[model samples]
Structure formats: C-alpha cells, structure tokens
Target: MIDTHTHLYSEQFNEDLAEVVERAKSQGVEKFFLPAIDSETHEKMLQLEAAYPNEMFAMMGLHPCSVQPDTWEQELALVKSYLDKRSFCAIGEIGIDLYWDKTTLDIQVQAFEQQIDWAIERDIPIVIHTRESFPETFEVLKRKKHPKLRGILHCFSGTLEDAQTAIDLGFLLGIGGVVTFKNGKIDRFLNEIPLENIVLETDSPYLAPVPHRGKRNESAYTSLVLGKLVDIYQKDFREIEEITTQNALRVFGMK
Candidate 1:
C-alpha cells in the first residue's frame, strides 16, 4: 500500500525513523509521499526523501497554516525556487485552513491560487488541505478549473455533496484515519463514492485511526485505514490496495 500523505520528517519520528519505516514496510506500505510544510522544513523533508530514495517521494508547497502575512511571499518564492530546481510528486498539502485563524483567509487564498498556478503550469498534481474552508477551496478550484488542473483533496473531511463536487472537479477524496472514527461520518457514505475517486492516507502524527486514535500515527497504520475500506466497500483487501494504489499513482503521475 502507498501512504499517499504523511510527515515522516516530523520530529516525533526523529528518535527512530528507520524503525517506523520498517514497521510500515512490514505492513506492506512500500511507498510514501511526503508533503512540504514550509521553507523551514523543506530541507528536512528532502533529507528524509534522500535517505529512502523512491520509498519516500517529496512534494513542495507552503502549508496554509504556515502562511504568515509578513513572510508568505518570501516562502512562496522559496517554493518556486525548489520547483524550478527539481521535481516533486505534487505541489501540496496546500489550501485554506480556517480552523486555526480566519484572519489569514485572504493571504491563504492568494498562496493557494499561486501554488495551484505553479502546479497547472508544470503539469503536476496538487494535494489540497482544506479545513473549515471546503466551499472556499472549491471556489478556488472552480476559478482555476482546467483540463491540466488535477489533484487530491488531501485529508478530505466534508459531506457527500462535497465528495461528489471534488470528483466533479477532477479531484479525488483523500481517505484517511478520519474515516475510522466513530463520528468521522464519512464512513457512512464512503462506499457510495466510487473507489476509483478515492485514495488512502494516514496524515500521520495527526489523525491516527481507531485502536490507536489518540496515539501518534505511523505509516503502518495505513493498513488499518485500508481494513476499514475493506469493510465499507465489502471487497477483498488485495483488490482495495490495488485500486487505491493505482489511484495514488494516477494522481502523483507515478504511472
């Protein structure tokens, strides 16, 4: 399985990174896609990728929460510089996150649009992180809608209507630990959304699935997410992995 979204560079794993990867690999999670948080952590993310090579793919972008009014432009310049220097799996974990601070909405929108412009121009995929701003995120996608504009709604937490809307916009729902929550609700109607429009993630060190809900999440926990899908979709585990892995490959342009 491919953990399409994760933060293996997070300090939480600094003590035993190899052990974590080994644990994940033991669970059949062979590929991991890491998202850049900002200029501060981009180096760390790249270092982790270099350490693992193809096992760990890196993405470049300024996370919305990191978009400060004083330095967002400078950070975005760094993002552009990196994209020009090398390739990334996607320009992501980028989008508006109003849950933390609504005041930065204007700047967040600009950064989101600018980064999305980079993705469209480069013909690369984007991984969106919409929080408490689903409609607003969709608005940006609607405005920037193009045949070449495609990506994932990373850590998607919206209604069934929102799922269909994202799919309609040529995006996939990033299914993760949230679907395993008793109140995550997405599980109720997840089967309704075609598996083809879905991809698996853990959002590790963040939304760990049940049985480890409050604990620190690792890539291996992706199997738990997949297990939930198996129950929800009522399909075999191998079939679910095959389809979701294909979805991740398609979104990341991995072939």
Candidate 2:
C-alpha cells in the first residue's frame, strides 16, 4: 500500500522516525508521499526523503494555512525556485483553508491558482488540501480545468456531489482515517463513488483512524483506513489494496 499523504518529516516522528517507517512497512505500506507545508519544514522533509529515497517522495507547495498576507509571496517564490531546481512528485498540499482564518481567502485563492498553473505547466500532479472551502475550491478548479490537470483531493470531507464534481474535474478523492469516524459522513456515500476515483492516505500526525482516533497518526494506520474501505465497499482487502494503490500511482503518473 502507498500512504499517499503523511508527514513523517514532522517533529512528531523526530524521536523514532526509522521505527515509524518500519512499522508502516511491516503493515505493507511500501511507499509514502510527503507534502510540503512551507519553507519552515522543507529541509526536514527533504532530509526524510533523503533517508528513504526510494520509499518516500516529497512534494513542493505553499499550504493555505501558511499563506500569511506578508510572507505568502516569498514562500511561493521559494516553491517556484525549488521546482525550477529539481523535480518533485506533485505541487501540494495546496488549496484554500477557511477553517482557520477566512480573511486570507483572496491570497489563498491567488496562491492556489498560481500553484495549479505551476502543476499544469510542469505536467505533474497536485495534492489538494481543502478545508471549509469546497465551493471556493471547485470554483478555481473549474476555471483552471485542463486535460493536464490531475491530482488527489487529500483527506476528502465533502458531500457526494462534491465527490462527483472532483472526479469530473480530473481529481481523485483521497480516503483517510476520517472514514472510520462515527460522524465522518463520507462513509455513508463513499461506496457510491467508484474505487477507481478513490485513493488511500493517512494525513498522518492528524487524522488517525478509529482505535487510534484522538492520538498521533502514523503511516501504519493506513491499513486501518483500508480496513474501513473493505467494510464500506464490501470487497476483499487485497482487492481494495490493489485498486487503491493503482489509483494512487495513476494520480502520480507512476503506473
């Protein structure tokens, strides 16, 4: 399995990074995709990837929550510089996040659009992080829709209509720990969305699945997310694993 989104570079794992990777690999998670938040953690992210070059891949982007009115442009410039310097798996976890502060919506939209253009120009995928701004996200996505634009909506927590719309817009819904939550309503309609339009992620150090909910999440818990999908889609574990791994590779253009 591929944990399509996780922050193994986070300080949360600084004490036992190797153990965490081994724990994840023990559960059959062969690859991990790391998303960049800002310049603050870029070196740590790169270092983690360096330690596990073949197993962990890094993405470059300015996360919405990091979009301060003062430093966003500088942060985006740094992102562009890195993209120009080398290649990354995607330009993400970038998108609007109104959950924290609604006042920065304009700049967040600017940053999101600019990063989307970067992904389109480079012909790479994007991993989006949308929180309390699906309508705003769709509006930008619809305007920038392109045959070359393809990616995942990381940690999807939206309505069924939003699911279909994202698929129509050339994106996959990234399923994660939330599906196991009693109130994570996506489970009610997830099976209705084809497995082809879905991929697996953990959003580690954030949304750990049931049994580990309210605790720090790790990549190993991706198996738990996959387990819930088995119940949701009523398919065999290996079958879901194969399909979702293929889905993730498809988004990353790996297979």
Candidate 3:
C-alpha cells in the first residue's frame, strides 16, 4: 500500500518515527508520499526522505492555509527553486481552503493557479486539497484544463457528483482515514465509484482511522483504511491492494 499523503516529518513523530515506519512496513505499506506545507517544512521533509530513500517520496507545494498575502510570493519562489533543483513525485497538497480562513481566498486562488502552472511545466501531477472550496477549486481546474494537467484530489471528501467531476477531469481520489469514521460518509457511496479511480492514503499524523480515531495517526493504521475498502469493494484484500497501488503508480508515474 502507498500512503499517498502524510506528514511523517511532522514533529509529532520526532521520538518514534522509526517505530512508526516499521509498524507501517509490517502492514505492507511500501510507499509513503510526503506532502510539503511550505519552504519551512522542506528541509525536514528532505531529511526524512533521505532516511528512507526509495520508500518515501516528497512533493513540493504550499498548503492553501499557508498562503498568506505577505509570504506567498517568497514561499512559492522557494518551492520553485526546489522543483528546478530536484525531482518530486507530485506538485501537491496545494489548492484553495476556506475552512480555516476566508480572507485568503483570493491569494489562495492565486497560489493555486500559479502552482498549477508549475505542475504543467514540469509535466508532473499536482495533488489537490479542496477544503470547503470544491466549487472554486473545480472552477480553477476547469479553466486551467490541459493535457498535462492531472493529479489526485487528496483527502477527497466530496459528494458523488464531486467525485464524478474529479474523474471527468482525469483526477484520482485520495482516500484516507476519513473513510473509516462513523460520519466519514464517503463509504456509503464509494462502492459506486469504481476501485480503479481510487488510491489509498493515510494522511497521517492527522486523520487516523477507526480503532485509532481521535489519536495521533500513523502509517500503520492504513490497514484499517484498507480493511474498510475491502468491505466497500467486496473484493479480496490482495486484489484491492493491487488495484489502489496501481492507481497511485499511474498518478505519480511511478513503476
């Protein structure tokens, strides 16, 4: 399994990072994609990736909530510099967020649009984070539509219509710990959204699955998310694993 989005470099794991990775590996989670929040977190992310090498991948982008009018330009510049200097699995964890603050909507849109350009120019996929701004996020994607514009809607928690829209736009949905919640809601209709269009993710150190809910999320709990998918798809565990792993490979252009 691939945890398509996680912040393992996050300070919360400072003491038990290796133990967490070992636990995750024990569960057959072979890949961990780390999403960048901003220039500040890049070094730690790189350090963590260096520690794991091929097992962990890094993505470059500014999280929407981090898109402040004062620092966005410099932050994006730093992101661009890194993209030109190295390779990343995706241009991601980037999009508009109104859940936290609506004042930065305009700037968030700007940051999101420009980063879309970065992804297209680099010929890489861009992972999206749409928080209470799906319509606005979809609008940007619609206008920026291009053959090269493709990515996963990370932490996707939208309606069937939203899911279909993402599919129509050639995007994969990043399913994470949210699906396991009693109120996660995505599970009720996920069976209708073909397994081929979905990818597994933990978004860990954030949304831990049931049995571990309300606690610090870790990659190992991806099994819980996997189990839920097994129930939803009514397919063999191994089959669903291969399908979602392949979905991730297709999106990230990884083997």
Count clashing pairs, candidate 2. Answer: 0
TM-score, each model? 0.99, 0.99, 0.99
Task: Give residue 131's error in model 3 in angstroms.
Answer: 0.6
Question: Which candidate model has the greater TM-score, 2 or 3?
Answer: 2
Could you tell me the lDDT of residue 197 within candidate 1? 95
**In model 2, which regions exceed 4 Å deviation?**
none
Q: Which stretches of candidate 3 lie over 4 Å from their true place?
A: none
Instruction: Encode model 3's per-residue lDDT on 104-221: one tens digit a residue.
Output: 9999999999999999998999999999999999999999999999989999899999999999999999999999988989999999999999998888899889888889999988
Which of the two, 1 or 2, has more lDDT? 2
lDDT of each: 0.94, 0.96, 0.93
- Candidate 2 collision pairs: none
Candidate that scores best on lDDT = 2
Regions of model 1 farther than 4 Å from truth: none
User: Candidate 1's residue-wise lDDT over 1-255, tens digit each?
Assistant: 999999999999999999999999999998999998998789999999999997999999999999999999999999999999998889998999999999999999999999999999999999999999998999999999999999999888899999999999999889999999999999989999999999999999899999999999999999999999999999999999999999999889888
